[model samples]
Target: MILMSPAEPGRKFIDSPAMTQGHGTVSLKSRNRNSRQLLSSSEDEQYQKERVVSPEIMCSLKSRIANKQNVANVTRNQLSTSHILDASANMTISKEKEERIRRQKEKQEEFRKHLIAKQQNNVSVDNTKNYCDDTALLTRRDLTNTDENSLLTEDSDLLLNTTKPSNNKSVIIVDSREINGAQDIVSTLRFNHDINVVAAQLDSCDYVVSVRMGVDRKQWSEFSNGTNRAKMTERLLEMCDFYERPCLIIEKDKCKPEEKGRILHWTKYVDKTLVHLIQSKMTLFFTENQLETASIVADLCQLENRKNCAISCPINLNTDQQNRVKFYRSIPHLSYVHCLFLCNNYKTVASFLCSDVKTIMTNGKMTEERASNVYNYIRRTFDTQMLPSNYG
Candidate 1:
């Protein structure tokens, strides 16, 4: 039997004689080792030629890369500088705008001051004439009634007695500071409205109509002034602390005779202040003139008087009694009047604690509900679980 073997890889097939059963066969053949080495050496030489780079070409490639890098760096620097220049330009423009606005405000304020000064100057002459006329009437009335000795005695009385006689009329306490600005209103209240207008140094408000009512009067110009805005807010808030029914009265602005300018529209600041006052639940009233404002004040005084809320001057209290009043005032929902009543009736916190709810109502003149709340606050047993978790 004749058998043939498979040819090996990377070798040429050649006819060869084999001593296997005296048969001829085809087998793989390989080249001589020296010839293979020569061929490999020649191929390496050609590869080296292809892979190797010339110095000139190398320098050229490096120069091209360097040029690209320089261009990129120049572009980045230009972009950064442009951004910086734009930022500086914007800053300068904003500064210019702010300066222009500040200058405009300054000019407006100066003009307003000048106008106010002019109006005051004009009004001064008229006020002087009116004062002289009032003095003349007073002299005529005083001269007819007494001798020099009696007149001398009554002069001191006249100077001391500035308040008008009430004659069963409602009384209104006017702040001394308001005398200069609201002389016309005061005169109107005294003579026309027949209100007992008493001028006193009131710290909390310009006018007090009742035990729980206060009024702060402001002219349009004063209310709208930027400088007085904070002062007005502070005054109103302080009034709120003192009175249950605090009111703000805005009177019309008085101008010079020839001045034709008027506030046709409110400013944004004015609108914002109005919104804030509304949110605070402040009572606001507007009047066209001094007479109208006086009428409004008179109406408030009469209304409160009808309601039996007439202002009661605080009675003198010793330090102990005063402390008692303070303690009573700390009770929830109790008014100053109710606190005074409690202080006067109970005389001590221990006594107040021992009283029943009905006794509290009788002594403090409080409603049943209010008396019950006080009784519960004083006598209720405290429980550990009833306390807030954060207390622990």
Candidate 2:
């Protein structure tokens, strides 16, 4: 009967055991809450200690935290974008600069090609470079009858000691119709003075010969027409560049009936335009003088036969030229800088100084020490204290 007894479904069973299990769970929860409270108090104490630190130290710590946040933000978002944007800006500027340089180089190259084409056209070329203080005329040169090679000679360096002859230099020449006895004129120009002839080999000399095209009264007049002959003058100057050089036309037969008249008209037209274009371009000489005219002028300025002279600053000078030479001689000489300018408007003084200047250029570039010696000799020879202000 005791074994058969079963517990009812709703009956309270093991009351002590239930209490023990519930008590264990409640104790665990209380222990967790106490641990949380301890952690919160520890955090508060650390915050108070930080507040007691100096402003400098607190600011530094805040900055460090902010910097760390910034780093995180940058790493998470725009790191690649900022790098790409900076690179793009630098590349854009570099591209713009490259484009500008390319355009300038293109223009220079194109101009050079144009000049080379003219040279190939059998035109006599002459490159005249003037260096001096006339600042105005220093860039211009009027060719007369003289051998350019002779002027370039060391002992015959009559005009300049620093002559920078460019391989791509330009030349100027005349184109005149054949006149009576044109062969004689050509021979005179060629033999008497060293004028370039296109028929001559390019390897032998640097020049392009431009043969006179035509001589007709009406055409010459047409070219020479307009106010102050402005239009005609421009055309004539341009005609020089056609062949881009000038040479005498040696005709075996007599000139055409209208040739002389046309030639005469052309000469007058050019004479009218001479003063205007002289600064930028164009050199003029009488048509009758022939092509040798330019060479002759070159020779006169060059000290071909003059002996080299030595000059020095003397304690006592007997001549006025001595003083002028000493003044210019006192200055130091630069290696690349040459072409002397003795500027004075007075005629007599200019003439005397010019003679001395000629002597100085007779020798090539010399050391600064030699200038004094050369100037002294010039002073002794010319006896003037001033130099010429005007020379073509």
Candidate 3:
């Protein structure tokens, strides 16, 4: 207790070992408990701080999430719209293709139907011909030996009987010699009036007739205007109009190779003249085979009321030869008939058919077999009975 050595202010000294140990243990436990409680309090404070957020930061996060969701929605909608447009375009293309195919099928069907109808008509005509042939054997009568001349005379008389006089005193003047072999056609007509046939080359006339046989390339080139054939044609047309003459232009059906074998009008090479004439009907145009030219000329002459004397001719024939004579006589009579049958141009065909059979045969250079074939073909092709009785 004496402060002899005041042991460094209040230093404690253990009196008993058990007491010291119990006190130390208690102090250590208390310190550990205090450290645990402090740690738990700090952790709770940290958790609370982490949980709390600023209002601005919360709004920004929400906006960012909302923007992401909107972007996703927009992208999905664009993809859907693009798919829809693609599908619509494909559908439209498909529809057009289908429509075109359908139209083509329809045209093909129509053509097939037309072919079938044509075939049926041909069959019907054949059946009718057979029926007529069977009936003719029983009712056919014997006929006199009438020559071609007699038949021609009869036809002329028949035509004269039916012709009505016209006030228009139009005369058809011709330059028969100008066209090669065309004189034969004019001579065959045997016009009642004084034929104004001239050997001189004429500039303009009522009728300008020309004939072409086969493909004449040089002649075609000459007419194709190296020297202005179109201008010449125009001038001719104008002259005819001024003179108050009916213009008849006759050309052969044959043309040059360049023309593709089509029987074009003479004025076709003349540019606008053809269209003008057609629209005005100022000129008569004819494109016929060389063989048919005589028939056309004869028809025109007969229509003009030209008088021709009938020639009476009789050929001596036996009972067996009577039919042959009749058949020969029928050839000339069918001139006008065949003309009308072939082209339906009554005047032109009549004039052509009225040509002398001998002249036609010579001009055409046709053999008997070929002529018969042509005649038979025409009779088979057209409804011959539909023609006037006189023509038939």
Candidate 4:
């Protein structure tokens, strides 16, 4: 109803709009300002609370971060160490495998050598008159005295019968490799000529005639062929190095009657080779057949016996002794016989080196020329600057 007049600041009214107001009067502008101020103050107080932090809390947080990093580093280190260990283990395993393989190979080699020796013994037993005769030759370890009489293993009768002296029954040492190819020669030497044909493992020759002489038998075809010439030359040259008298027996190829006329004739190459061989100081003998070759061999054996140049008893040298022999063999014009003599006389390389030229000549059974050569060779000065570029 009644429209009341606006109340004055100092007046009081009952049931009026002014009666609902508080004792203090306020402007709308000021009230709005106050509300805005309260909101701003509350926001500032919340932001301060959020920003404030304790030193202990900050340190703990930092420590947690550091601990995580340390843990990561430790894990990385462990992984690296494990990898290294694995690599070392693999290396050790590989080394062990290599060692095992090497031992196996060595065993195999030793076994192979044993088999070869056994086979050689069996063959010698079956072919020779007495097993002990040949075995004694191999078993005699004392090479200090190389007397021919002491070395002879045959029954004294076989060697010293007045009717059939040692000269009449000559001994020829044939290479084991030649057994298959030269069966006829072996048979003829044994049965026909009554010669003691002993098989051995000869490195440089098919037949060892004496301590000084060795023979290599070659067929005419091998001698004439261009392909085989180089190999044959090298072999013959090696033989020359091994023996004082290296002989090559060129046997005519046994062809059928129809093929006899078609046999290859000696070419210029053959003549050239022959000239080269002669120049090398190698002896050559031509034979019509194996029978004739056996006769020639028998004749050679008899001649060597007469000259007291019989073959020495074969001995199985150990590795070191064999190497020593090889070193001795390297000397120019030194024969295998002389090499064996040197080895037999000297127990050690030092003793051999200490010996004078005279002692070397006596012990090695070498001529003055050969002994001088060996002595000079041992004492020869080796100057690297004076050597050719290709020199080994």
Using TM-score as the measure, the top candidate is 4
Best by lDDT: 4
Per-residue lDDT of candidate 2, residues 177-276 (tens digit): 3223234444554455544322211111112221111111122334345554654444444334322222222112235766655434346545644455
- What is the Cα-based lDDT of residue 287 in candidate 3? 48
lDDT of each: 0.71, 0.40, 0.44, 0.74
RMSD of each: 24.2, 24.1, 21.0, 15.8
Candidate 1's error at 116, in angstroms? 56
TM-score of 2: 0.18
Candidate 3 lDDT: 0.44
Per-residue accuracy of model 4 over 15-78 as CA lDDT, tens digit each: 3577546423556668888999999999999899889898999999999999999999999999
TM-score against native, each model = 0.41, 0.18, 0.26, 0.49
Clash pairs, model 4 backbone: none
Query: Which model is ahead, 2 or 4, in terms of lDDT?
Result: 4
Task: Give per-residue CA lDDT, model 3, range 63-133, as digits (tens).
Answer: 99999999999999999998898899889888988998999899999999999999899868755654464
Model 2 residue 272 lDDT?
49
- Relative to the true structure, candidate 1 has a C-alpha RMSD (angstroms) of 24.2
Q: Candidate 1, residues 111-224: lDDT per residue as tens digits?
A: 999999998986685456544644554466367644422433333212111111224566777888888978999999999988777776666688988767888888887887
Using lDDT as the yardstick, the better of models 1 and 3 is 1
Question: Which ten residues in a row are the worst by lDDT in model 4?
Answer: 155-164
